[model samples]
Target chain A: MAKVYNFSSGPAVLPHSVLAEAQSELLDWHGSGMSVMEMSHRGKEFMEIIHDAEHDLRRLMAIPENYRVLFLQGGASQQFSMVPLNLLGEKKSVDVVNTGHWSKLAIKEAKHYAKVNVVASSEDRNFSYVPAEDTWQCDPNAAYLHYTSNETIGGLQFPFVPTPPEGVPLVCDMSSEFLSHEIDVNRFGLIYAGAQKNIGPSGLTVVIVREDLLDRALRITPTMLNYRVHADADSMYNTPATFPIYIAGLVLKWIEEQGGIKGIAARNEEKAGLLYHTIDSSGGFYSSHIETPFRSKMNVTFRLRDESLNDSFVSEAKKNGLVQLKGHRVVGGMRASIYNAMPIEGVKSLVHFMQDFARQHG
Target chain B: MAKVYNFSSGPAVLPHSVLAEAQSELLDWHGSGMSVMEMSHRGKEFMEIIHDAEHDLRRLMAIPENYRVLFLQGGASQQFSMVPLNLLGEKKSVDVVNTGHWSKLAIKEAKHYAKVNVVASSEDRNFSYVPAEDTWQCDPNAAYLHYTSNETIGGLQFPFVPTPPEGVPLVCDMSSEFLSHEIDVNRFGLIYAGAQKNIGPSGLTVVIVREDLLDRALRITPTMLNYRVHADADSMYNTPATFPIYIAGLVLKWIEEQGGIKGIAARNEEKAGLLYHTIDSSGGFYSSHIETPFRSKMNVTFRLRDESLNDSFVSEAKKNGLVQLKGHRVVGGMRASIYNAMPIEGVKSLVHFMQDFARQHG
Candidate 1:
């Protein structure tokens, strides 16, 4: 069978080597005589798996000594509520920049715990461009400023991290683009990412929070949702997502072997450039509405010149081993989510299919 | 290499067949050309997997049509707070029957949301037995009566389901023994189980709530913790634990092929009986503190006549392919957690080792 290039937003494609390694150890992990899935979270074998995963992630991201890396469950969506529940402190409101679907969801959940101030929103322009930092209304008394580093649905990535007002922390939802590039850990108070994209699987969520910010959780917050509880226990406040963490550890090792984050960033840029170049050179047959400067390097979104050909373009592309290229239901067209694990060859195959489909229809 | 018997409480042993099948399909699921982990939650492939899992679980448990089976993240420990947050609507308190460590944790979390009434408690006896249901102090105004069906740490299982007062609903945490026996779903207003034990892997939680009970979630409940939100979206409110859910689906299928819940219950009984008989025949060499009538059929806890030999007993058992027999750290002794997936052969091997260890130490 031909290997298919998966382009689903998330759960997205993973490195073939990681999957093969996991398959080999599915039933017996390191001669422990138990699948990573069946081993107790508190057992020595699983403890090492989780510990090594955290260590590798810290090394890859260059996380500071004071930051607590929490492997949580419930994906990034749960973090939307937990952020407010844990960080709202004495402040009555939070500042949020609405880039697209995910940021909006975060704002909605934050409103349940505190006053939500949508400082800036790109929705006015159909989320085709990110609002400039200068245009954002900073709230001096707000708890924190929140933003999505990349909008998976709109195919928009913030060109630069927003600078929050002095004393107010900056929190980022880096779910889709985490680990694709090097990041400065000191710049943000907290950073969270769902593992399905670049990390590993769907169940595990990676939360990196500064040490001093752990104690601000609301008293009514559930123990599992409290960052302090997780930080205090080293993210073993509960059983945790054992198998997912194990797989994520393997992915982190893979990242290191592939030249760490810097290497991943260079390859990612090349893949995005190749696909975007194809769209640009298609003589308007394939056009991208996103402003080039703010366009996502992870999810490349484009549209066929004749809207009627969209269905055929997607279906025909699947026959040639390109799958999950259909745009999000809310925004119809084409989207190639080239996450960290998507090789250069996969993007090239997608670009070739796009050009051939455009020429045939044109 | 010979297969070894695992007895960790959870994430405990899964059927070898389930692990083998998962290993074979880790890279490509049924020719979809994508690992189940890579499929989008909204895609038809994942939709089918989740739907089939929920359907099989409902059938196996004989769940009523009005019940909504929700596949949620955050283990049962998270449900500790969610229970009170969602069910303690107008009521200011909840009735709780404390059986062991898990029940104590639930009560601790419940106190954050509502006043907790200790209707009954076995903590007075070091959680060695279940408090009599007839002796429970019924709270007419309480939102619900919460109890743990099986205490994993103490190795105690409730012999009978507690009947809540006419208007009060019954809620149960069946985490450790969820699918090991036949359960009448109508007996309770809600049943929740962490999937690490009998279901599949860690991270995925199953909540079977009666339809009418969904609307009781408090206004302050986090969106992810709210049952109504999950029910409305059919448990796809956001990116779920995709791979965990898929593996759980396979587990449910395995349960069906083994002749459903009834078959699993009979096998569990035989396994538990064999282990208990071995302990009883050892006379003063082995002793179980839990009373025979209320002893668990899942986790068989016992202490050697010479308590100082605990370490060697565990080490010797491991050498003989019986692992994780050391008791929970909190309650030191030996605990063999024989869940639904533990075969009769594994139990026999464990019994044989226990007899030999007792003879040598006696």
Candidate 2:
């Protein structure tokens, strides 16, 4: 069957080979006489699947021995609430760098549980770039400093990890760009990512938190929402989304087959670089408002200079087997989310379509 | 490929045809050019999938317009916390009847958020039967009355719905018995089920709550845990368990093909009857202690009278293509969870194995 290049920001493109392998085993996984979904979560088959998923993720990210990897549900949005509930400890406030769309959501949820001290915000310039580090108002007495590594909607990337004052931990929501690139895991106190973007699918969230941070939940925290409850149970406090975890395990293997984090990052660099090059060299025909230094390689956003041609650009691109090129309504123009699974060929096909359309409408 | 009869409780069997159909469409659903797992939850394709799932479920169960159906996460265990937080309203206490292991868990979680009144408990009888309804000390001023429609671990089920005092709402955790048969949704203020039992898979949870009961959630309820938040957003408050919901929709259609709810109920009655009859006739060879009238059709728990035969029974059953017959530690017996997807043939096979083993060991 022919497959199209999918650029959906999330519930995004998955590795083609991984999908094929899952299809072949949908009815019987490794002669187990059951689909991955039908297996008991505590049964040996699923135990190994979850075990391997956490193992591979930890290996790929170089997660330290002091951290516990929790495969949780409820997306990064739920983490927005859990962050303050678990990490605020006895302190009453948290410092956050407001990069763009995703950070603003984190801030809103944080304010519900703690005093949010906005260290700095790039919103003053329509969020085109990350505000300079020297401008950030670090709170020495704050419990932690939080930031989004990648703002999936606005396509802005933080080029550097923010440093917190002594005794204050760092946290990040790396949903869009996790596993696409390598990073030092020791810097952050907690890191979480929704699987839909670059890992597997919706319904699974990966949280790697330093073991010491496990306690300190608020008095009113729901048991399920408390980090310690899940960590103690090895994430099996309940049936832990068996099917998605299986697929994530497969994705982890695919990540290794692509030669681990370094290889995936290089491939993502090639795909994003090609698409952005097409946008850049199109002269005034195509425009990207984000400052070049802080643009995201995961989600490449741009606009057709003649906005009236938007429908034709997206629809006509779909006709040529490139789909979901329309950007989020908040950012409104075009977004080509070229994650690790997006082959250079798909980005090339998108680039070819872009150049031809620009020539015709220039 | 040869398949075995799976008897694990909760993350149990799914209809074979549904699995096959999902396998066929795993790569490109309806030529949408992406796997169901890959489709954006907000996209048109996913919208249709979720819309049809809710429609078919409503049709099968005859759910009323006064209730809102939500596809959620965190499983039924999460609902333990959600129930007390959402249903306690202005009342100081809630009434509950403890039947088995599941009810006890619900009671434990409830005690954290509300004043819990244990109206009755069958635990005194080792949870082998439901305590007499006449003995229940229900509080008329309680916020709502809570019960477990079925206990998966003990294989005990309620033969009839319990009525709360006038104007005190009724809530039920029907996780293990939902969709095995139909019931009057009007009797309850809220009903929740984890889908792994009979619907689809582990990650997604199905919730049906009266719209009027939606507003009683405590202020501390996380936005994602609030029924009103999901109901208002049509369960897309954030990205839901997309793939599980799609598979659940397929299983709902399969239920219709197998003669809808009435047909399913009759089939369940026949399977449960055959297994129970076989156990009773075995005399000293096999035994089930649950008062026969209250035995669950979904999970049939039994034991070989000779305790030492336990390991061989499970291992032999596995060798013969019947698996996961080991019961929960609390029950100390064999449990064959013959859910909706479990064919009558699987039960017949178990019965045959039982009779043959009895003759050899007797």
Return the TM-score for each candidate structure: 0.99, 0.99
DockQ (Cα-based) for each candidate: 0.82, 0.78
**Residue-pair clashes per candidate, as listed?**
0, 0
lDDT of candidate model 2 versus the reference: 0.92
Candidate 1: tens digits of C-alpha lDDT, residues A1-362: 56899999999999999999999989899888889998989889999999999999999999999999999999899999999999998889999999899998999899999999999998888999888889899999999999999999989998897899998999999999999988898999999999999999999999999989988988878889999989889888888999889999999999999999999999999999999999999999999999999989999999988999988988999999999999998788899999999989999999888888887888
List, residue by residue over B139-171, the lDDT tens digit for candidate 2: 999989999999999999999999888998899
Regions more than 4 Å wrong, model 2: none
Candidate 2 chain A has its poorest 10 consecutive residues by lDDT at: A1-10
